[model samples]
Target: MATLMAVMVFGGAAALALYALAATVLPQASRIAAVLRGQSGNVRFEPLSSLVRAERRIAVRRWAAGSTMTAAALRPREAA
Candidate 1:
């Protein structure tokens, strides 16, 4: 029972310390990180069109490859 209480106290202190550190650090960290993101004065949040285009291209390529593989597998093995 005493051990359990000790563990709970230690865990709570550790959590609070971690939370305080993160709270102190995150704002400065994010500001520095955002600079690397190269945000212009105007930041627009929108879905990227290029992502959708690339996804479609990948899907088409996969479908073509799958069809070719299936056709090749369906062919009878040549007798030796």
Candidate 2:
């Protein structure tokens, strides 16, 4: 009976601790994974800097008219 009680207590405590940690971390983990996968829309991080930067370091420009824009415009506005 004592052994059974100890096992139950230990199991319950372990389960509770696991649940608490998951509840705290799962949302952040999912968000980070989503950002890494380029699936997040807003790219917002609460109470801190955004996961995505204001300016992208690399950009791919598509020419719909089969003509490229001037290098001045193609470069970032700040770079120009």
- What total of clashing residue pairs does each candidate reach? 0, 0
- What TM-score would each prediction reach against the true structure? 0.38, 0.41
Cα lDDT of candidate 1 equals 0.84
Count of clashes in candidate 2:
0
Model 2 misplaced stretches (Cα beyond 4 Å): 34-80
> For residues 1-80, could you state the per-residue lDDT of candidate 2 as single tens digits?
99999999999999999999999888789777878998975645454333233222122223343265667766766545
Per-residue lDDT over 10-30 for candidate 1, one digit per residue giving the tens place of the 0 to 100 score: 999999999999999887785
Lowest lDDT 10-mer window, candidate 2?
51-60
Q: Which stretches of candidate 1 lie over 4 Å from their true place?
A: 31-80
In order, candidate lDDTs are 0.84, 0.69
